[model samples]
Target: MDTRDTACPPTDSAPVQPKDFIRLIVEEDNRTGRWDGRVHTRFPPEPNGYLHLGHAKSICLNFGLAREYGGKCNLRFDDTNPLKESDEYVQSIQRDVTWMGFNWDGMYYASDYFEQLYQFAEQLILKGKAYVDSQTAEEIRTARGTLTEPGVNSPWRDRSVEENLDLFRRMRAGEFPDGAHVLRAKIDMAHPNIVMRDPTMYRIRHTPHHRTGNAWCIYPLYDYTHCISDSLEGITHSLCTLEFENNRALYDWVLDELDAYHPQQTEFARLNLTYTVLSKRRLIQLVEEGHVDGWDDPRLPTLSGVRRRGVPAAALRSFCEKIGLARCDNMVDIALLDHCIREELNATAPRAMAVLKPLKVTITNYPEEQVEWFDFPWHPEKPEMGTRPLPFSRTLWIEQDDFREDAPRKWFRLAPGKEVRLRYAYYITCTEVVKDDAGNVVELKCTYDPETKGGWSKDGRKVKGTLHWLSAAHAKTAEARLYDRLFLEENPMDKKRHGKEFLECLNPESLHILPSIFIEPALAEAAPGFVCQFERLAYFCVDTRHSAPGAPVFNRTATLKDSWAKTERAGLAGEG
Candidate 1:
């Protein structure tokens, strides 16, 4: 994707509205000079999976606020846990953040703050606010009671601070085996907030860190590391999803006890879309199980995947703006997302003609040896978009569905003895239907109205339907991939309708590939990531994986309408 072309277009230097909660908070904070009027923010992503649309919302919130308030947003990889994290994830995240048009103040990692975090943990232990719990993993789980019940304190809760500090250092030095001993905060076990029930602050993880490598064997847990990292960076507002609302108390308690420079932690509802799975684990399953090509598969919701499928960044930005930030959870219709993309493309994308599943049509009356040229505007509304010369010949290709041997009463497309306007070309009347030996209609023979050039009748005849066609002799052959949702249900994880393993609900028809799509010769040299609207068909992007220099492959980014979703629901109802 072209960053310059896809980013939010330059406005007239007017103040943007506080369209969402994050912006509203920033405005209020600025009015009161909170954090001394500093609006610094950060997009802290766990380097375990590819960034998805949910991450996009966070990116927009962090960077968009910084841009509007003249502050800064840092791109930090919260990579403390090395078990599931990797350098591959780190690279993909950087590429994704850049692709979304966000420039970080600096690239920092949580692992970079490990030594500081460990020292802070020691401070907590010395202050008698933390200890090394010798309980087994299972025993700790048993002691940490249910939500309605208060947890019981461990027998070794009062182990001297000196002893705790020694154990912690030894744990860091690889003296302890995994899960044998963990550094737990000495916060109240009877506290109503379960996270404060002697929560484990550091754990012995033998895995190698992507950045720090094997220099350290111990890692700080997210609950302990996140608040300290935010305080360390002097972040004004630590924003996160509502799932962390329960953990906020632990965040506050850890920073308050340590006397750290704490940032305000705010929770907003995370984004959920119908017919989509947003969980990082499930997304990985799709890739590992060969259910998807990779993180960038068009059917997947990963930012890279969607970009590969040709969704413009502007469209994605518009979507984030439309959804806005809210306090409660809700399922956004994927159709609304599709609508956002279509709305953006309709206003900006140049239209071109391409025929998938083309049916050959030969003008029998016209001389087969002759070919003519017609002018079509690249964009109908924007005459300044100029024109492209399309070749017109006796042999042409039209959409297969555009013709019906037995036409329905309401159908306006071509039929026997029916007349229609060939878009940007001429009026053509169907004269004969050529059949194969099996009595199947293989082709249609038509006659063009020579006087009706550029599809306008000189005598003022009206045609309700205009069909997009390409000359068979002049069309460039290419591959086109049509994409749909990855799941068959509105909420794929609904266990009542779908089993516990909802990955089984994967939509079988997520991708439909047509190898023989014919386009105008202009698209012959289209490079990967190139985007254009395929006239009446859909908006498309050149397939990044397969499309290279001469062999241009386009992926249907989105259709002109949300008919696929409607079709899915209708099919489900029929099944029911």
Candidate 2:
């Protein structure tokens, strides 16, 4: 679902029409006075799962189009399937769209049109265009033969209008068990189009609806409900992904037969990204099986999850805009998505030093109780962002990975007798290595050159490497959650030699929790949802649930270096 090319909002411009084929057609239609110069769009999502990056693209397209044309977009939930839909999902979806910077003209639900749809079904039955079939569910499926064969008509296909009406009313009255009887359109049984072979219009589902709450037992099928709902709303264009292309004929036929206002259905390729799965069912499985924490796990493609992970809506929108709309589906490289966040954060996030896996460094010559302040620029590109004072002391914490006891050739970081610059602080040389009883290098004893204060040498001595450090006394404890790819396989759905489910390929090390991270004390004051770069580590944002006034919890949004760039560079060098 996360793709670089998406229909993101205009990051830097007045509203302009996108150069996609759909827009071009809409433009021509507008020029020719289509819909009387009205441009109304609706983003209809089924209230079953959290909206993912896929929904974000549709949201941008629908809402973005409305914004450009000075029209209004409606937020509609296709909550026809009460078995899966929830009020929680409806509310969450509304919040997510609004958070993405879209204002809905109105709120709507497919259930709102149930009464009108029921009347339409009765009219169809009266006109001999529809019939109530008494065939069992399995019998009906068996009758609806394979693609190469024609389906057999139900034995009760010739039921009179009065009989059909009575049976349908009884079905609605809960007289039938679930799937006992169904209403199907009396369409061509010998039609080449499989959908035209008397598709089901209504099925008996005695379950209580999320909204209606036991108002009726018979539920209208999607094919019967969607087009009628669109017609009721007077949607100018029923824009949807290409997978629904097969249903387009059914959508058209139902409206055409009813002599109702028909909205034009246009299909574009859906968004698919490599190394990620967009299917909500699969996502639900991951969550239910404890493969992921929840829908908003940073590793999830869900909008709330990504937003919680510190990806700006503007960046995601920019990615969607770049991807554009196409007539055919394609798998986008996940690198593009990583690049989008990197592009945005580089310009915006304020940088701060944090030491994960802290290695204690003690300056042997400096006074132990003395603390000096160094002026550190918040951001390099934005000077107006100003500066914050970082406290430098004799005792400091550096990244454990930034030192070596036995230095390799070309190693530029801390080592015995080797000098390195503490970023924005001073030049330091490792004098001794403090090891544990088990011979594990636990800490380093270092001495700083007073002449090289504030990372500049008075004698112009060269230090090849610079390391980010924090004053141990001024450091705050935090929990940092490092996230990696959810699936190890580029395409998880590929069921090859391993006769295992996609869950089997779930990356075991996808999420790593570092419980005792040492960040600057300034970060302790940071509120939930605050975003900042951890100097040399990565972009991180405070977790809203776990972060509070005293305890700060950070989630690694993305790495300092782009992993995709490494792949591309390797590709250029002809490496596997």
Candidate 3:
């Protein structure tokens, strides 16, 4: 996921205790010996789709707080919807959470509490706090009312407690079709908060659950299952996004009516990154409609997508740290995320030469069949990263964009008759340019200065430009994918404000494929998922899903440039 808040090395992130407001709250609670000085949190995600970058915020916050407070955090799958939830989503969620560098203290699913939840529903009916409602889905929505008006009472609102229990039990016994009847809390129909207006606790769905199979014909809704599951597990701080602020009341009402243990429901702003979408239904549509390759497509904001794109777990964590915590919603700049990515890769990724748009360069004065090797360091700043033997030959490849037949003023790259340093090798001056029948420049003929071997002149003649090159004889051709923001607009969702759909705002130039990229021979040893810098270019990772043995594909993780720092940036916010 593209993001601004996150951190590296889970160990580097722990500071005796992280000082966010949430952690401060935990600290204050501990000082008071609340809940006996115990802190328990949970990440309750609906397992219907792959977890996206927005989920990463909650993951880090919950997991990070648990680590700081010496408490435990559970990975709970709120699998309340059978039709949409599945084992595929369940496994993917686990993988994504682990990829983000967190291991849950307890792994569970709401389906595990199905029996207890059903019994609780029955108990509520026995006390007249809840009852079976025979209203159709449409009827219920209409009667639920809007913010300006209060909802009228349901026709069956006054059903006797015994009759409600019998109908609910029969509903669970497979006597009802889907949506024939529902179990709802018997709260006030005219309550100011519509969510607490007799919210449905259970609904009939004969469909088999991913984990429970056909063992259950009725399933509890999220609002009911969430609170009870928290109480049952003894969670002390039930953290949720600010959007769930309204549902907090419903969460408490159920637990209160049952007199069950209550967990404090605290809401924080959800992560919302620019130029990205995190809606599960919309994300699924993008995949199913062939808008993206799959859930792991590098262009997507999915954790798998970012992982495939070569975002390090540490970088994401570092981003979380940069974003910190916010009670109010904000739009975080994608540039800030790019800034973090570039910073992490610059320090860690091994540097290698690559020419995405290869322009052949032949040295006229150099001897044929002659080759020289330079002991090139993997990183210029850190000697500990070590070095590799870089091959140099008479014939070489440079980036086509690096050269200009008609050079611009102050251009520090290659041009005809201009001398420039060929990194790790000699200084070459362009003497000739060759073009195809279409008048497109295809090659350049240059003469290397023998005195400038090892990319330096004994006379100390400084060259402003330094270009990365690969020996034409040894360099391997690999595909390089350059990805950009998925949407041209900063907030794609805002397209609706213009009477248009978000899909129409797709950035057509989001992905560029250079299938004939030439890289340093040493890159042959780089395995899939190994991230490295294409010197003077973007940091790229070996594509894990599309690469084959002896042939690798590179996906651009981030550019070397930091737009956020170099320019005035705005709409800096987190995801929801």
lDDT assessment of candidate 1 = 0.87
TM-scores, each model vs. reference: 0.93, 0.94, 0.95
lDDT of 3 by residue, 1-576 (tens): 222232232466556433566777787889998879999999999999998888988999889889978999999999989999889999999999998999999999999999999999988998899989999999999999999899988999999999999999999899989989999899999999999899999999999999999999999999999999999999999999989999999998888889999999988888888888888888999999998999999999999999999999888888888887777888888887888888888889889888898889999999989998899899999999999998888899998889998888999888989999998789999999999999999889999999998999988999999999889999998899999988877788886565558888788899999888888877765789999998888999999998877789999999888887665343333221
Ranking by TM-score: 3, 2, 1
Worst 10 residues of 3 by lDDT: 1-10
**TM-score (C-alpha) between model 1 and the true structure:** 0.93
lDDT, candidate 2, 1-576, per-residue tens: 322222425767687444777776667778898777878889999999999999888999889988988777888988888799899899999989988988999899999989999999999998999999988989988999889999998999999989999999888888889878899999988889888899999998888899999998888988889899889988887889988999999999999989999888888888888778899999988888887878889899999899889888887887788777888888878787888888789889999888889999999999978989988898988999999898988899999999988879999999999999999788999989989999998889988888887799999779899999999999999999999888887778877845557887788898899999998878888988888999878999999777878788899998888876677687779854
> What lDDT does candidate 2 reach at residue 35?
79
lDDT of model number 2: 0.87
Task: Provide the lowest-lDDT 10-residue window in model 2.
Answer: 1-10
The global C-alpha lDDT for each of the candidates, from Candidate 1 onward, is: 0.87, 0.87, 0.89
TM-score of 2: 0.94
Model 1 C-alpha lDDT per residue in residues 133-168, reported as the tens digit of each score: 999999999999988988988988989978888988
Worst 10 residues of 1 by lDDT: 1-10
